[model samples]
Target: MARHHTVRALLVGGPMYDSLYDRLPAFERATGLHVDVVDRLPHPELNARVKREFESGAADFDLISTHTKYAPSQATWLSPLDAELGAEIDDFLPQPRELSRIDGALLQVPRYLDVRLLYYRRDLLGGSSVTVPRTWDALIEAATTLTRPGIYGFLFPGRDSGLFGTFYELLVSAGGHLFDANLRPAFDDAAGVWAADRLAELHDRRGLTPRELPAWHYDEVSASFRRGEAAMVCDWPGSHHLYKARATCDVADRVGLALLPSGPAGIRAAYSGCHSFAIPRTARNRAGAVELLRDLTSTAAQLGEARRGAIPVRASALAQIRAEAAADPAEAHRWELLTRTQEAMIIPPRFAAYPECEDAIWHAVQRAMTGVVSPQAAVREGAQHIVALLARERLSPQPNTV
Candidate 1:
């Protein structure tokens, strides 16, 4: 095969990930192989575009940014990396490494681990009697009491995968499962209703969130909290650096971190996964793509991102961060809370049609939160739609790989 000097890639772009791309120049300078970023959109848009390209047989990019939850759907078009990257894979943290594979084949390089934590304004909570809210009811009470003229009580992503993920964690925390023994939809039960009701109460019944929340995604929710417009938010680790940056955040010094509050069943579940990079089977510059993948996921690269608040997947990078955290009280508390919360992390079921299922659920959830329907009715409708979708796609529940 002729060696190609340029590699094209489709990447997920945002404030949280833009810093990593800033280092691409170093890679290009060292290897003399240019990287062309074909497209850079958020996760949902990137997923849709990649699906369209793959289905139309027009996937010309050599590499793409992907997440563990969406990898199963794209596995057919991704090239297996076991033989070429096995040694590098061995150094990754075990859970992230497991999430980077599909059906026992290493298909991607793990970049960072993502899990949601409750981020609040320490100034707001400290003066109040609310003591870090250990349960959902307690959180609601705190949020209600904290609501003021300019500040809303709570904030969360209201659409797309973010909304679906929020609902998933709440459902699991309530002692519910997404699927039962036969892989059927099991979220329409009482637990599901309870989860949906909480979201409804926050948005519609009590008006604790912004009026435009139904259209907001992860970025919007994070921005709202950074502006000090909300007292609390459930957000991912990727936003940690921004939350602490005095330049971008109004309440930077007042920020506080805590594990997610427990549900009625006493479970504190967090939606979690790893963001990664993969080579497509149709990649024109396979060698360059592989080399770029290795460079992007190297310990040095991961350490840079980790210092900026992302959870590194490489064991060495993680160790370095832990040592650094030991000396900083704030960093030490954040790291300890995140590590303990990992025990309650939950990932979506592995299946090719999972994205479609997520859409069905989030739409129903949006309807509930907007008062188009009751929580019970929304859960029932969402479950029915998922069952129909699974049948249409002829998909069976695949066992979890991690």
Candidate 2:
């Protein structure tokens, strides 16, 4: 017999989590455990809030909507779920399946995955006879040839976190990492310089992005791409529906999806992350929280989310998404996007102090992008700051999931 509990959940709100929020009532009814959800914030903000709320006092949340990378850092805040998750490992796709554990403790049950994809305007590019780019240099060439008075070639966020993610993607694709085995900053070398220089040339030299690239948010980038102001964008998969829906997008009909182009490293590093549900160690309703996690990740729930534009965490849901091709070719194509992106997936490093290191690098990226410092100088300075940070704290690199 299974124990039931009334659980309080803190969920990250946004389109990515909409289906889960919408389906909570049914989940409560099915399990007879009331789930009281706190307000949802944007992804990064929600994680920040969770950390704040958890640290302010005793655990206020029994269950939470979190990311796979976060579980490693906050392992103490989360209860081990290995005994609860027996034999369920085979249900998930590779990324989530491998990331669910922290120090060998099953701490999170993944809900959905996020990966970078190449979103482009098929109409414009096809007219130029430009096929999808398979490499970064090719992408740059296409962007250069495609840029004009108003229509830019590439659109990506330029704010701090966005900009950092940008450099991180390039660094990974160029065979570099934020930190090496000894927990020292490793992104200041050749790859970092080239990445910064390329970005500088695109925005300042050739004008491939918005004039106010530094001020742009992710939403603005998506909007520009959706409005056909940009020929292509390297971004997350959420834009697939937005670009395909004629009612919301001007270029919906001409949109084309492709894998993120390979970088100088000769591999397509799939920049990725996932949203997951986790129970707190101090939860008052442990049993109910576990059940809620199970139900939210169920096939029906995942399918509902998939239809609403989220990648399912489970293998069965992925199969169900593939089945959509029989009824609607467009929907099927979307599923195929998920499949292709999964193959090139690259997860960020996980550790309690990873955010601090990320912020330091972000500041450096900003300085380089804004011409406050050359890319080479920015990364060199950033690496120095990181060494100091490492000295102040005992940080260690965790093993990669892949």
Candidate 3:
């Protein structure tokens, strides 16, 4: 694994990733692999840079940050890590341990993870008779009990990717799957119908959530929890720093994090992915790239990442994090919440058409949420739309950009 060449890296911003960003020089000194970090851009620019530079046939960086869902679509331009991986990957959390491959080629190593979790108002729940719901049925009971004059019980994503992920997770937790082994849509059956019914039930609840959830902005989804407008919410760990800030969040000290409530099938929800390190196939420093990835995603690195609010990718890092956060109850709760969520994780479908598929599915979920149609009816028609869309896509395959 020893390498002398410098590894040109382009990483994105995350509290945990900051450790790497701050200590690139030390990494080079210790490993003999100098890293020239390119501009540490915001997520959108970073993603665009990876695509644009690689597609332009200019391999400027050796190690580029990647994600599980969308990165698979660009796998052709990335080098496969199959030959380089070994027992080193054994201890990572399942969902974040491996990157999605476009066509059976492993193109990246997972670095850190993010998962959907429930954030509830601890102060409100303590006064009520309800405990955190462990199942969908229980959630309804809890939400109903919590709803009073000024506050709502639960909140979900109103628009954007959050809506899609939440809908997909509910579907999966209720024993429904979007695609079968044949890469064909498989969500039109009874399981799918049952899942939608559960979702619609929540949407139809009178005082349990926002009356005009569809009209609520996406940012308001999390803000509602912090401002005490909603008693419970489903959001990512990256937003934790903000939600727990005393100056910003009214419920800061009273915030409690929990795993997504269990569903009809008894499994909790986990719609998740990771930021990873990938080597472009056109890179001149293959050895250096692999060396850099190994060092960056090491167990120690993950532990350091967790201390700053980034969820770690490795299983062992969980215990390390709990120990480190022993003095901070809230941070310890985060680590515990993370472990529980990771156990419930099951990766979403990994295919190039997923973005379009997600949009199609979100539309149906929105229809149910807005009360235009019943969950059964929304899914029945949603499944039909997905199948038709996939069929059309197959007829005239869209070209890949990167």
Candidate 4:
């Protein structure tokens, strides 16, 4: 086989993940192998594109960005990494390592562990009598009290998987499971209704969020907070650097980090997963892909990303970041909150149809929030759609093994 010198890739591109791409020239210089980014889109778009490419049997890229939750859908076409990348896997945190595996096959190398934490404006909280909210109900109360003409009390991504993830975290925290042991839909119960109603209340009844919220995605929500438009937001670790950078954030000096508030069930839940890289079964440059994967997930690479506020999946990189953070009070406080909240992280059940399931639920939740449908109707209809989806998926042909 002729060896290809240029490795083609499709990657997740945005403020949060793009900084790592800056180091690609260095990889090229050292390895004498070029990294050609064939496509660079935000995660949701990237997921949709990858699905389209794979389904049409046109996944021509050598390597691509993937997520633990979405990996199962692409597992059949993903080349297992365990044989090609050996001891390097040993350096990853157990959760990330396990999340990257499917039926015991290592399918991806994790770039970061993503979990949402509460980001608030300390100045706003300090100026008001409202203390930091510790529960969902209390958060509602605080948000209502803090809301005014210029600023909304809370902000969140209102579309796509970001919206679904917000609802999933709240549903779990309210003691609702997404599915029963048999994999049937189980989110139409009272707890699920409660979760949906809370979002509706924020957007519809009380107007605690922007009127245009239903159209906003992750970047928009985070950007709103940076512009000093929201008092509080739940955001991933990747956005932490932007929140703290005075040059980009209007409220940078007033930023504060904390664990997400608990729900009625007394559980603090965060929808979480690992962002990773994987080689395609159709890769034209398999050797080059492996080398690039190693270079991208190396300790130094992870450390650089960690410094920019991404949570490193490599154990050594995490420890080094922690040690460095200990000297800075603000960074230390941020790490402390993240450490204490690990137990509260909620990873979704992996399945090939998971993205479709998210689509159904988020659209339902959005309809409810926008007052196009009642909360009860939304959950009930969403559950019904998922029941049919799962049934159809079960009857469909299983993916081919790599």
- As for candidate 1, its clashing pairs are none
> Could you tell me how far off, in angstroms, the CA of residue 88 lies in candidate 1 after the best superposition?
1.8
Q: State the lDDT of candidate 2 residue by residue for 10-61, as single tens digits.
A: 8877533564677778777777778777677765677688778788875578
Q: What TM-score against the true fold does each predicted structure earn? A: 0.97, 0.88, 0.74, 0.96
> How many backbone clashes are present in model 2?
1
Tens digit of lDDT per residue, candidate 1, span 311-393?
A: 99999999999999899999999999899888888888877899888999999988998899999999999999999888877
State the displacement of the C-alpha of residue 157, model 3, in Å, after optimal TM-score superposition: 1.9
lDDT for residue 293 in candidate 2, whole number 0-100: 84
Q: Residue 355, candidate 4: how far off, in angstroms?
A: 1.0
Candidate with maximal lDDT:
1
Cα deviation in Å at residue 308, candidate 1? 1.1
Better of 2 and 3 by lDDT: 2
CA lDDT of every candidate: 0.89, 0.77, 0.72, 0.88
Best candidate, TM-score: 1
Superposition error at 243 for model 2 (Å) = 2.2
Q: Would you list the clashing residue pairs of candidate 4?
A: none
Off by over 4 Å in 3: 1-63, 82-95, 99-105, 144-150, 197-220, 241-243, 282-296, 315-319, 325-337, 392-402
Candidate 3 structure quality by residue, lDDT tens digits, 1-402: 323376778887643246566667777788777787776764545767777887888767788887777675566678878788767667876545545444556677777777878888887675557787777678777888888887887888755456777777877878888777666778777767777666566767454777777655445677777887888888776666667677768888888877787777776768877778788887768788888788788888776666656787788886687777888877767777787887777665666566667767778877877778877787777778878777765421221212
lDDT of model number 1: 0.89
- List runs of model 1 lying over 4 Å from the truth: 1-3, 394-402
